[model samples]
Target: MSSTQSTAQIAGSGEGGKAFPIPQGMSLSYWLQGVRASPLLDHRTTEQLSKSAEVVIIGSGMTGTLTAYELLTRPNPPKSIVILEAREMCSGATGRNAGHCKPDQYRGFAKYSELFGADQAKKVLEHQFKTWTRVVDYVRKENVACDLWVGDTLDVAMSKEVASQLAAVYNDYKAYGGKVDHINYISDSAEAEKVSRLKGAQALWAWKASTLYPWKLVAHLMKACLAKGLNLHTWTPVTSVSASPSIPAFWDVITPRGTISTPTVVYATNAYTSSVLPSFAKYIQPTAHMCDKVVPPRAYAGSRALQNSYNVRMPGGTSYSINPRSNTDGIILFGGNNPNQALLKAYLDADPNRLFDDSLSNFKPITDAVRDLTSTAFEGWSDDAPAAGIGPEYSWSGILGQSADALPFVGKVPDHPGQWICAGFHGHGMVHIFNCAPGLVTLIQGGTWADTGLPECLELTPERLAKINERANNVGKRVV
Candidate 1:
């Protein structure tokens, strides 16, 4: 039997699979939609490698699976490669996002320029641009059956404090000679509201983003890798890794049942990366990310579905990324700042929901807040038969790593030979992993620490790590 059971839910609905009475669409995932439309590829349960391979990668989310896929398809493939996952593909944060893909280097450009320098910030943007192109190309070439739409994005500001920030960012990018081709500032709330389908006081629009089905993306990538003969095993978690300067490098990848040893290991576990690299335990911290499904009630069927993704800064001091999904009426992916780790104790203590139902009291606040916001902001939305009218189809929480500098660490573990890491995308994995993984394959093959045009700040060093630790101290806060 497989070690990890498959779990899924309609968006926003609690366990029991009932539709939320909200205005957003259904809560089912696009991946699940695809599976329902077709067939799922076969996979392995926990399996042991009779002997060590040239490389062993842990975690099969976007980062791990993509890394494996890239390595195997490279001009010079590793002698042998193995990928192990703690759960099914896209079972983690990789499957939970809004699928907004963008080379949105601007998101972190201003922050990095302030902390690092203009050169470093520029390099980061350049790197993300490369990654974005690679992602688009891969999705097209691989013929991934996901809804991939390309266009601009909007940053809707519900309050003046946020509008000013949006304006400042827009001007700063322009001053830096950064392209804001699709970015425009609208001072009139009426226009902004109409464009974003959001009730905002003002809005900043940018033209370089796309939205797709995240679960479909993950499944397609996984299928592509499988077709390429990549070896993969699910439910095999790497609990600990042992390495030393004196001893030859070897990784002891632990699973629920057994352990596998390999010469080369890649930690693509993201939020759970610290579990393998204890040295980085203090540097890489896992923070909770959440997404909600909001359905539009039938009364507002006249409103067109949002074409682009949006970031609305709510009056309650939270920012949510809203998009229209293939299944969900509307999806809101939100990030919380400096959230208390203990706040989710109850949910963590219970059994994960197998079906969708919205009966839990503890889960009320988040969906309630989203419902209230949608009711006020969305044009002419009405509550349907569901209690909330656009009730919760499903709401879920996953872990993502925060980098001190808000960039991914995508190279060898410094001073530790034969080990590599590619984690800490900070909710920007799709924006960076395609380019990052290929570059990582080059470094591993060339056996050099050559900078691959990614931000040098991603390098794990005494100084870089120290900065990350300091940032973690203010956990739940956005580093950028």
Candidate 2:
């Protein structure tokens, strides 16, 4: 789930403002620290744009790259497919995230059951779990050394309120006949603390998750797809899309380089989708997110490092995601809620200010809270520990898309025949993109929603869009 949306609704609907371009030199992401030297960083498929192609995909993040890869590798693939990106490859949320492929096994089951019934809720959870499995399978089968680490993720509660909430969800989901054989819950506070190895652990749940070098994974797949003839153009932003003047049943994707008229266009743009397809302006949203990375002391480093990834919930809706990158440096990625509630209030707001720009200044309190994680949230960090008090100096911000239902909007665009979307992951793209991208391939090949094998709520239907629009209008200026 999106940490920003848990407390407040600042993930403004992609509305109220014109779509802005991502400014250069944004985040110093540990995952992207060495990306500048990679040839794929600025690679363009062609020196000059072709007037036409079989398909055009916007945004070169995971969704876009995977969508193109899936299409190109199909038994009867589309010919001359092109990709358009506004910035460097994989520079979006996929590149800046904490590199988690964790699935929501029980946390959101109750909410989905309440809203869409138990069956759809099960589908949602199952879909994510399957996506995680497929991702791990792909990495293992291909032997991609992107630092893939498959292990359990601890959902630790540090407060009474969160403990009670977790208990309720767990009980409700269990009673509803949801699967729990793969999950382990430590409801006893003492046992939870012992199991999680955290100071204030109240209750905790552990389930399978995978963490890897997300940028490397996306780049590897990008290169593989390029070998199969996918036209990828980085730093070429699609300004807008419209009905082609000369070609019937075709949409012209307008970029600074040129225009491509194709009957099939995929908006895998996530946070930037509304800029090109303005109708999404009312449904999907863009929110600001922050993350930091630091080298850990020997106590939490090397072969003795934490084997489990984590989601630590503090009091008053403050939470943090801790992922020990055992695959690379012993650096732990710390991310989540801005501890200062006052800053969110002051956030370009007091209203629903947009957060599409990736360069938005990060809240210092976020860095401060994460830096002190070793002492404040953990167990057994001595004063004599190696290099204590050295906090993370590499804190950066990225943009995440938030949907009305905290799920993605996938399928054909409303009333727009050829255009399709596979975006609005709510900061949970890693779990959704694998299946969503393949499902998109099914749809592009003239398959029905049922053929796509995705959850019912994920379908981007006219009714769902209108319902979300109504909710946004009811909230008035601030669209959550």
Candidate 3:
């Protein structure tokens, strides 16, 4: 449940908008800070390519790492599988995001029902729950040192009007036969405020959710894959991918280094897919987003800290997704909401190349907005909290692939065979990528959609792509 006015309500950069198609070179996030082992991360498994590989994967983000892991660990895996990254390993959305494995259980079901029917809405929501479960299970099974914490998330409504709006959606989802067994709602205002520890909490919704060190999780799996005969190249930007004229039914993946001919090409490149596959320029619109890592003030620091995660909601559909770490530092991961909505609106709609660059958020008003998170949103926050620059010590931006339909574009590419994609996850990649990657691998292995165990609506087809365009044109905006 992430909110960005620029992402939710805007027009796509369009198919012709490919001026700034690739990712920027330098980017560092809160999660990406202090990472060790530069050799394993940016090491060239083989200096020179083998001319061809059974599989070539683009983007070394969550989708890329998970897909490689699934393929390598499974029986009868591909002989040569290569992963190409535009920048450092896992330096994309997966590395920068506020790590929340919470799914949109009921909030977006109504909107989803309108887009892809109620059945798909239910399946999509269910898939997120399963994905979250998989992440938790994977961390425990692998004994990952990624600071995994299994807990509940509090969806706190700041006003009674918002509370009523949420109640209507909850009722709507339940009426449509969406699962409600795992959810618990607090309707009483006093009880809601007490449970959420927010001053003006009018209502509260609680369910199983978690947060973790996202960069650590990806890097951990990446190390395991390297040991399992995976060839990974970091900072290798793939300029383009074209059909092999000499070898029919083969793709020539052209990089600055060299071209690798392969029968299979998987695009894990979420926001930057348009760089290699121009057809996806309009379908997967890249949008720049911001997040912060804050050292909490005295009131919310140490023993008197925020216990659970929260989606502090306000009117006008804007929100702040807060992750109160269950660690010694108790550093809060704060994200969502843009202070300069008008500026972002113009940037997203007008400039194509600028949106793909996540190095800097053009909106400077975000600094003041992020610093005011605790004081403005939470209860018992000090007025004179540690003078100046203490709040929001580190704030960075990452580019997210905003899908035309709000759902991710998974499975095979529409018109191109042997070319698969699993991207455009909005900000819900943490909950969706765990499952979507394996499903994509299933399709790549000559299996049907049913064999992948994914929702039908998630499949990438010409029909769906056409519908995305139709909606953007008909509705005058791609957001809903």
Alpha-carbon local distance difference test for all models: 0.62, 0.80, 0.81
1-480 per-residue lDDT for model 3 (tens digits): 122222211222345653443544545677777576556557678887658899999989899999999999998999989999877898988988888889888988888889999899899999999999999999999999998988889888888899999999999999878898888999999999888878778998999899998988998889999999999988777887889987889999887788899999999988877777778877887777777777777778778888899887777777888887966468888876644444665755675555766665425566566656567666767655466645677566788888889889988787788999999998789989999999998888789989989999999988898898888888877763
Better of 1 and 2 by TM-score: 2
Q: Which candidate is the best by TM-score?
A: 3
Better of 1 and 2 by lDDT: 2
Clashing pairs in 2: none
lDDT of the structure predicted as candidate 3: 0.81
If both were scored by TM-score, which would come out higher, candidate 1 or candidate 3? 3
Q: TM-scores of all models?
A: 0.80, 0.92, 0.93
Maximum-lDDT candidate: 3
**Model 3: lowest-lDDT 10 consecutive positions:** 1-10
Candidate 1's residue-wise lDDT over 115-141, tens digit each? 678777777777777777777777788
